[model samples]
Target: MPETNTARLVHRLATLRERLQPEMDRREFLRTLVTGGYALGMAQLLGVEDFLAADDGEVPIVTARVRENPDDPFSLVEQTRDVPAEWYAAVQNAFELNERLARIAYTGYLGSAVVPGDYASGTASISIGVSNEGQSAREMIRDVSEGISINTETIIEIEEIEDGFEYAEPRYVESVDDGRVPSGIACETPSSLATLSPALYHPDEEEAFFVTAEHAFKDEPDPVGHPLALPLDRVERLELGTVVYAHPGEDFVAVEPNGEMRPVSRIAAPSPVRVRGQYTRLGLADLVARGEELEKVGALTGHTTGRIQGVDAVTCFTDEFCRRGQIRWGGEMDLTDGDSGSVSYHSDPDGRDDDVLVAGFNNARTWWPGQSYVWGVSAYKLTAEHGYHF
Candidate 1:
């Protein structure tokens, strides 16, 4: 080749590399924001140079979605996606505004969720749930903030609650089976039977726990340290673990395994699937925008799938204090009494077909007249508030 032609080619290659440098740096910055839980303080530290320099069409947002190494949580890899710039801005603003609204948590405020619009729409809105008695709260919500849209729904308590408990045979593990227990089977509490959830790991302690709904032991004289067992049949049961920590507000309990058997990162369904990681706030929003369905394996309901109703939700309906970072998905039929602790999940985009990322634990279902969906504390919320991962 001629010297002039070779020089031109080399120059073009260098120019291309220079153009991609900013984008690559931006990706890394966004990854830190997400993995760090997107705290406002952290954002201030990591200046938005690349974010601000980008054109108005689209921008890359790091998803809290991670690919977990089952044996090592520290080795988790963050994921990213290119989203419309307008949509990204709208969702980010909506999230911040949602947090502000939650802090206020005015009287009669039942709950709220941030809904992200589709890509083409590039919009976001907040759905605030208020009890009929919260007239002042409704007025505050209407004038809460400007720019971001707010939608309010009146939650009317029903006179008679529909029985959501369904009768089903309990699944038991054989005595000589593998030492690793998969989730979605029946585990007995001192007071009631509840569905098992995927393994939750604490990075700092490097410990894994067997998780279930805390309400399962609501009637216990002393809940903590209470033995949690697996029923072999109607008459026999095997000791699985003991409740180490119980967060009633989040409606989940972490059990310390007795070492006879450890919790595995898998779910028991028709075709067993492994738990890869979990969805982030934006990851769940992406699913909602794409109209994706969440699948779950519950003790009573068995395997079922349903649409995601809302993400980053705050619910004050059932408890004295409000629960933030809740996920509202599926419907009443997707969960039942014995189904509490079952996890809602979607196929992992970066993993094998049978691999799935958890959305959250299915702690309860709405029995109210107007709403009909299952709600639980999201995995992201748990990670942010407490250092737990799938």
Candidate 2:
């Protein structure tokens, strides 16, 4: 071979090596992510495509449910866990399909939820609820989702609830400490009583709010005009705040704190649970896959625990517009009329003693005879739609 030809070949090889170095580095980082069993989602942060390749290997996924900085609710530090590649692919596909179903939101579409299968099965499904007049809609859903598995149920008319459905009296705020009030207690609206939710924080405005069910003030001509008053045991009622934002689609209201006693990140229960953060959509699905249960403290029902039935759910049973990104758990017995605004929660898997993550707000429950479950807007949904976090 001549010298010029040899030099040209060497240059070509060098150029090829330069192009492949970044790819090699990315693969090495991914391998570390698998073996090390943790990641900060650097790929997503950097907008690096092909970070996760299709191979018969493990992959890292976010499993942590808290932020590194509690004050900055949006600063979600990704805590990841390694899982089989096949399982990740299956779950990811199911999630995508679920979102598609939600977007379609066809007529008579009562609701839907995602149910992830175990690791060994590497499968997932969507549970769809349809009204009696939804046969065509059901066929349409089947047409759009070809390979995904779906379970369908027909929602029928429900009879009126029994007249004498008795419940315990409302719980009032006995006292306040450090100028802060604990959640899970009762607060009085102009029209009705409701349970208080944990402190809701908005990242954009950097403001904290005391939240409750918007429907509690339905009878009032102007919900925002009336103050949200906290009834004390023996003392005069203390005005906590007034409605700053009313989200009827999600069925919750955010009250701007007006008095010294503001909402705290704690629940008033037998064993007090501290609010750390909230679960993502996939996080809730993972809990369902592992057969985990959610607990809640309502003013009337007190503390109760129940298994998660579904996640990323959509419900159109009662309202004019469909409510998306909901969670269905427990049974109707877990919630009552006064239990509205109570939040569903679960123990933080990666937190200190008594730390819990907010799942969603318990707004309403099923009344039909054949079906029985409590449903509400998930915490992830609230954050995704309105930028509020617990």
Candidate 3:
């Protein structure tokens, strides 16, 4: 009976070895064991840490890391037509000239005002650029003086001055006179200046001479509103994803999978905001002059999107911290104090490509609920203006 039992056991062991031979190959077995051990270690190090701190064994559910939404058609309208290379060059030169002229005119005026303590007395001239088509140029100059008050009664006034082209000859006539009891009597001297004729004073110039092609080209009428479609393929081409970090007071400290750290700005965005509308609508008309320059550059990458929740209120270190003139998308993407500098991105259908543009950077979030006010620095603007690329 014992001999028969031993024979049966031997037969069963041989059958089991034959059945498990494929899985027990030395190389395969080693690979499996290593992989399993690595996975287990990672779970214990990362996943287990997050899970153990919870009140219950049940893991807390966080919002999904990505979202897909239908593209809006109104956001896709191309605002400008492609101009001939030569014409485009001229347009660019003209735009530059206009900007230079504006700076020169304003700075000259301010410099004059600065003499004699006028600046100290809060008496300074402010100059703003206005295009001929009744559109204001992008550059604005604000001069605030802290000393010297203006004596309007003693000052001479000039009206209807037509300053000619910056390159043209000057046509201004100026004469200074002291205030005294004398009507047209050159008592202290003719203390006044005026334009003699339309030669070249300070008249508003109207022409398309220096208009940036981007600004000159009007939006074509599109009944279908195709511009709003999210360019999914382009987004994918950029390989965009958000960089998550922890907020340390007013600043952001980078958090790595290994718990390593670094410091960053305290901007926050709980949800990705879709940017639509033309460059003009976004207040980027000025930067559009350099659009061609931007075309040669690369877009930002590694940006991802995730939903931020449980935010009651958010505050910035300074009132003007995120109040710059950047387009903001209003929605219920909650981000709290320690969540600043978190990147928000929309999912792209095409994956990563070269043509996709990085629209904005996380900047700030409004505290109020039902009013998801999130602000970001327009990446488009930075690219167009400063040739910035990330």
Top-TM-score structure, candidate number: 1
Give per-residue lDDT, candidate 1, residue 328: 92
Candidate 1: where are CA atoms >4 Å away? Answer: 1-56, 68-70, 158-160, 174-176
Instruction: Provide backbone clash counts, one per model.
Output: 0, 0, 38
lDDT of 3 by residue, 246-329 (tens): 222222111111112111111111221222221321112212222211110001211123322111111221332212223333
lDDT of 3 at 211: 5
Better of 2 and 3 by TM-score: 2
Q: In model 2, which regions exceed 4 Å deviation? A: 1-56, 64-76, 158-164
Predictions in order: lDDT: 0.81, 0.78, 0.24
Per-residue lDDT value at 34 in model 1? 60
Give TM-scores for every candidate, taking all chains together and pairing residue i with residue i: 0.84, 0.82, 0.21
lDDT value, residue 94 of candidate 2: 72
Q: What are the per-residue Cα lDDT tens digits for candidate 2 across 121-208?
A: 7678888888777867877888877577899888777435532347687777677867788999998897888999999999888888
Better-scoring candidate (lDDT), 1 or 2: 1
